[model samples]
Target chain A: MASWAPTVLASDTLIDANAVDYLIVGLYFAVVLGIGLMARRQVSDSVDFFLSGRSLPAWVTGLAFIAANLGAVEIMGMSASGAEFGLPTVHYFWVGAIPAMLFLGVVMMPFYYGSKVRSVPEFMYRRFGTGAHLVNSISFAVAQLLIAGINLYLLGTIIQALLGWPLLVALLVAAVVVLSYITLGGLSAAIYNEVLQFFVIVAALLPLTLIGLDRVGGWGGLTDKITEAAGDNPETAPAAQQLNSWPGNALSGFDSDLLSVVGIVFGLGFVLSFGYWTTNFVEVQRAMATDSISSARKTPIIGAFPKMFVPFITILPGMIAAVLVSEIADTKAGEQVAGGTGGTVTYNDSLLYLMRDLLPNGLLGVAIAGLLAAFMAGMAANISAFNTVFSYDLWQRYAVKDRDDDYYLKIGRLATVGATVIAVGTAYLATNFSNIMDYLQTLFGFFNAPLFATFILGMFWKRMTATAGWVGLVSGTLSAVAVAFLSEDAFGSLSLGVIPVGGQGAAFLAAGAAFVVDIVLSVVVSLVTRPKPVEELKGLVYSETPREDLVDADEASYPWYRRTLPLAGVALAMVVVLNVLF
Target chain B: MPTAPARATQRRHRAGALDIRNIIGGLLAAYGVILTLMGLLGDPETDKTGGVNANLWAGLAMLVVGLVFVAWAVLRPTYVPDGGAEDPSAD
Candidate 1:
């Protein structure tokens, strides 16, 4: 488990599940399929299929909002990060997630919900014109397919690990479960299943956390063990760095403490988090499925409450695995331990090892089912979002025009099937990389960062022109790609190593570069070209839209806790306390 | 045309006919029952989870949460209006 060693799943079969476990997993599948069929009854039109007819309550959408994100990355990747980096990994939540989420709910959702666009790219079309809309649709659609494939591959890998089934069979099993629901009921099915999955995931992880903490004698005992390990191994990071959350050099891969803090705050927190949360249609779609704009505004704020505490279950377990399990401890100390998916163990196996060490059969079944639910929630989000963009933005706008609503609804269902099949092919494409997180971050940097820049600049500065939109997006994406090629290990051995940063730091640098270059180009081009008339920018531009239109008039009549601003304020205060305590 | 009690019943049925609460509540309750039974009859597996009866405790907690969800839905069913498109802000 050397730090620089390749990260791949390639060992012996890891779990020995029994009949009870299989029964629990089967029950979960039945419920999932049942919900899909029930949701199908609600889908009578294209809007129903694509956006749940915009009728779900706030709490449901809120839970689904976070559930859609609690994917393989949030579970396996974060746990692996926890085992590797210790307490510093909490910054990814407190610093990187909550603030941006609040901004999305408070500032951005109204524009999206008010404009009544079916997809994020459609919003782009209304704001910038055909050029940016075309670029955004293609990139977003491709990104979803690639991401869905990653989720599908991880789901398949877990199945193979559990049951010793063939890879292709596991992959098909994973794909079909997700495909069936999304095709049957569309966004409504995905959202409802996500809500169920969110609860199942908590039920599974909370037990693992409590048991692990009890075994390790709670937080104090865990810290002492980490300190002991740090003292024993001089090659690893100091115990102080591991125990504390500030400066996060171990996680950020920066030599200086200041650079790490700045990188985390600006790069990870601002550019990457804001870009992904605000502009990425996968997350936005959940918020967009609310019954009202007020509910939409409340969605991410409600999700933020659970989002902040997730580290307790995900990261703490990884910390426990590092100390409690011998193989993980040895691997952390740079020993070549034998056992895992691959021939050698990696930090990515931390959650599985901990589960195996602690959970008995009945609980083990629930945990396995939870893992499946998480992966399915993630893949369903991607497929649902992909289908919407493909049907409304791509096919309707360009491929075929003025088609009947029923025809587009049929097209949406077909797109779901097509995307899932395409995702199976992309699943193999994802296997080329050693670390899935690195691959995912690079993709986010290339696609999301420049798009955020274009969005923020265009939204505030009405002078930003249509030409500026596409040109800025194109140049920004190219710059990020160029930066990735120049950085160390961003493209594996293909990187030129001129920039020196590797892994997540390279991703940060790329996103930052993309944002700056895009802003500069957009400003330059906007100054030269004519802007869209002020009348046309009513809901699209910030200053032009009325303040009353951005908020719910009935909000003041509700109790303090139910209002958006008060809820957001409470969430903000809680996260600050968590940051200070951790 | 209709009695007051009849009108209330009609309104109740009109709102959230396919309540998500029913689904979530039903599934969690089912899982809770299974785990609780396994805890009572099967081996406690104390050796594995630091001498704690994890399944029994977790199952009971889940049972309570599930019941609360069901009770909440029964007490306060979601009130979606008849017209699905209720975008008041839209011009």
Candidate 2:
């Protein structure tokens, strides 16, 4: 087990920053707060607060969709994965995220947009009744809080590392800044800031990646050095395994290459990815904010273009850090290094160490600002999604049935503040796990995998019943929890070690178990129960909805780029190219 | 009196003034300016980046992209119909 230590790094400060660096970070904060104020002018109602009034353009929502997912967990966790496992880490993006994103855009979005539901749980309520809806809403809210805490934790650590502030002070400051913007303008503030952050993040990381690559010669040089390093350390993965993306045993934590491939494809790619991109309200909310149904359909498809290339800037930097930074290199070589957010250094410090080793002052400021923006974007996405579900899905639906729109809007705002406060507490919970991905992937298995199973089965199979929905969800989640507890080190010391695999492989196993269990229970219970009537299933079920309602009739009149199919086609071809080349 | 299309175009221009592109452009340009100044006058610290002026190049790139966004917002602004239906089910 990786020893858990003091939450804050022992070192005084990781990155040295002068006044100019502070000025740049300050400018970024000013611009972010200014955007929040501007977006406040646009929010007058609950709908505006929750869904950007459903009036944003496709391109804006598309960028926000990717940015919301790009939060600090993605940046830090993926880099950590990259440093620990080599090229195989790209599967999380190219294989795991893109296809599922494209599927959300093309296959499921029509049902969501056409049905005119405010959130995913509302759709569940429509299809399967109150039981499934309540189950989904409560679970989703809890998951968002936990995930938000993870983002908050990373954000605080970055602040602590940069300014040498205590972790608690940094946490409070980060929480307040996020709470301020989200409370002021609601989802509009979050989305607009996300759009800005997307660019800032690119500006920050792109230079770091390029500079790191230059320092290590180039891509070929990186490969050669990695092979040499692997050769020197018998404890590390083979040079071939570190360099190749296929048969990812190191990433999956499986001894057999065949099991690793199966685990990644079925577990991570099919179940977990689909569960997240298709059903998670954080990403779906961005797509739902677009003006027209066609635009909504195109949002994730557009996001897919950038999603495929994210590995280069995110994961490749970790790969570079593993080679270039002496501390990261020593850690990877099975040697202990000191001075990180944890008392002892781990792979999570790869990106920070790289920035310290390279990057001059001006660029360092940009990088710091970028990391802050990413974490805020991540936490804001969680809080905003949590508020929407809390107000519209759980609190308003269950406790107060017939309130005014204004009352619900107030509730949404309160939920945002409440969730943020709760998140600060949860952030401490996140410090136990050194590698955030392990914590996160396990959560996805428990929440998203089973939810995806219930959603997909109910959406396509018209005969699925409401009783089946709630039953399947409860069982699937329990089974996943059981599997995680059984897996080695998945639950820290609580893990029973019955399942031999650990880390991401255990996550994949748990997700697969959840998906299978949910599907089986839903099918069995559905057979014995009475299904919803055909008359009420128009937009909710695939067979009942007319083809005409699923697509925009006017799309053909526009240019090819404006149509959903053509856009999705281009995205698919590009992702295929990325998968093949890398 | 203006033609219908002309009036529509004018309305679009009004919405365009409130476009997010302007904010993105303004901020990027502001950051770009500071970084560019730092690149010119402040310590280059070329040794850290293996003899590259990273700040100058990154700043210039930000400036160019920022201007492009501003130009796009001005040239082909988004068209949001006046008081469009806020409710999705109403359509």
Candidate 3:
């Protein structure tokens, strides 16, 4: 098991900020606050506050959709994985994200937007009655709060690393800043800030990548350096093997413990990626905020363009860090040093060390500010999602029925505050996890893996019954937990002939198992039970539903090349090219 | 469709130059300019990491993109439609 204790790097090597860095960071906060205050007038009702009045343009919503998922851990963790695993890590972007993003936009958006569900859980209630809704809402609320806590924990670590502030002080400062804007502006404010953060992160990290490449004599040089380092250490994997994107070579059979082609294709590409990009409210909420049906449908499609190139910024840094920092060493029992200052580095600190070593004062400040913006955007997405689910799905249905719009709006705002307080408590609890990213993936396995099966059956199959929905969800979650516990010795090995694959691979297998279990149970139970009537299932089930919005004949008369199909075609080709090239 | 006066009122409520996109674009452009200036005239001590002045180039790129967003917002502002009511079934 990885060590849970925080690594203490040499104090002398810590980041030293000049006046310019502080000024830039201060300016960023001021602008974010100003945007929030400016949006206050736009939010006069619950709909406006919760869903941006569903009037956002395509470009804005598109960028925010991807940005909402760009949590601090994604940036740091992907880079860390890059350093540890090498080229195979890029699968998280290409195979794991693009196809699923496209599926959400092209296949699912019509139902989600036309049916007009306020949240994903609301869709559950509409489709399967109260039982499914409660199951989805309660699980989703807890998940969002846990995700918010993770975001806070990461932000605190980054702030403490950069400014020498105490972790508690850092957490409090971030909470105050995020709450100020989010409570004031609501979803609109969060989305606007998310877009801004998208730009900031790209601007900051692109430069870092270019500089690192230049110093290393470009990509070819980087590969050579890593290879040379690996050659010198017999304990490490071969440099050529590390550089290759494919799972195994002639020398070693399916070498990586973290991934295999089978696992990648099924576990991540099909299951986890679809489960996340398709059903997760944090991402879908952004798409749902667009001004029109077409715009909402186009949101994730547009977002996929930038998403295809994100690996260059997020994962390339890890490759650079691997070449710059030393190799992994086990200094004591249950403690492994992955290499940096003080003769040890946790993989999580890879991005931190890169910033310290490469960036100067003015740029360092901008990068730090960008990182902070990412953290806040991530937190704000979860908080806003939590409030929406709580107010619409839980509170409106259960706590206070027949309330005015104003009353619900008040409840929504209060829920945001309450969620933040709960998140703060969870942040303290998160300290026990050995790796934040691993813990998060396990959480996804427990909730979203099965949730996707429920959605697929509910949306496409008209025969799926209400009883089947709740049963599938509960059984799927239990099976996932059981598999995970069995895989680990900590829970005593009850492995049912399934070999343990560590890290992402383990999460993938658990999720894949859950998906299979959920689908089977849903199919069996649904076959035996009475399905909802076809007339009532209109717009919810694809076969029974008529398209709500038809394209203009003038627009339809345009050539095939002018349509969205071409864009999707190009995206598919690019994914193929990337996988082959890498 | 709703009446003209109601539509006009809805449009009026949504109308503003201070749209979130405009605000974000303006802020990014302003910061990009600052970073560009710092890269050009500030201390040359950053060369220890590498000879490339990353701030200047990154700032220039951000400035151009930010201005494009500003232009997009100004030229094609979004207005709320008269019939843009939530689908009652959504609740």
Work out the TM-score per prediction: 0.95, 0.96, 0.90
Candidate 1 structure quality by residue, lDDT tens digits, B1-91: 1121122233345454357776677667777887888788888888889899988988888888878877777787777766454544321
Q: Report the C-alpha lDDT of model 2 over A247-356, residue by residue, as the tens digit.
A: 98988989998999999999999998999889999999998888889999999999988888889999999999999888788898898777887657889999998988
DockQ of each: 0.33, 0.33, 0.23
RMSD in angstroms between candidate 3 and the native structure over all alpha carbons: 5.8
Q: By TM-score, who's the top model here?
A: 2
Top-scoring candidate (lDDT): 2
Task: Provide backbone clash counts, one per model.
Answer: 6, 0, 1
Model 3 CAPRI rating:
acceptable
Q: Which ten residues in a row have the lowest lDDT in candidate 3 chain A?
A: A325-334
Report the C-alpha lDDT of model 2 over B1-91, residue by residue, as the tens digit.
1121122223343663247786677667767887888889888888888998888988998889878877787787766655632564432
Model 2 misplaced regions, further than 4 Å: A1-11, B1-13, B79-85, B88-91
Q: Is the docking of candidate 1 incorrect, acceptable, medium or high quality?
A: acceptable
lDDT of 2 at A562: 88
Candidates 1 and 2, the one with greater lDDT? 2
Clashing pairs in 1: A9-A342, A10-A341, A10-A342, A10-A343, A11-A341, A11-A342
Residues A313-416 of candidate 1: C-alpha lDDT, one tens digit per residue: 89889899999877789988999986665456778788888888899888999999999999999999999999999999999999999988899989988998
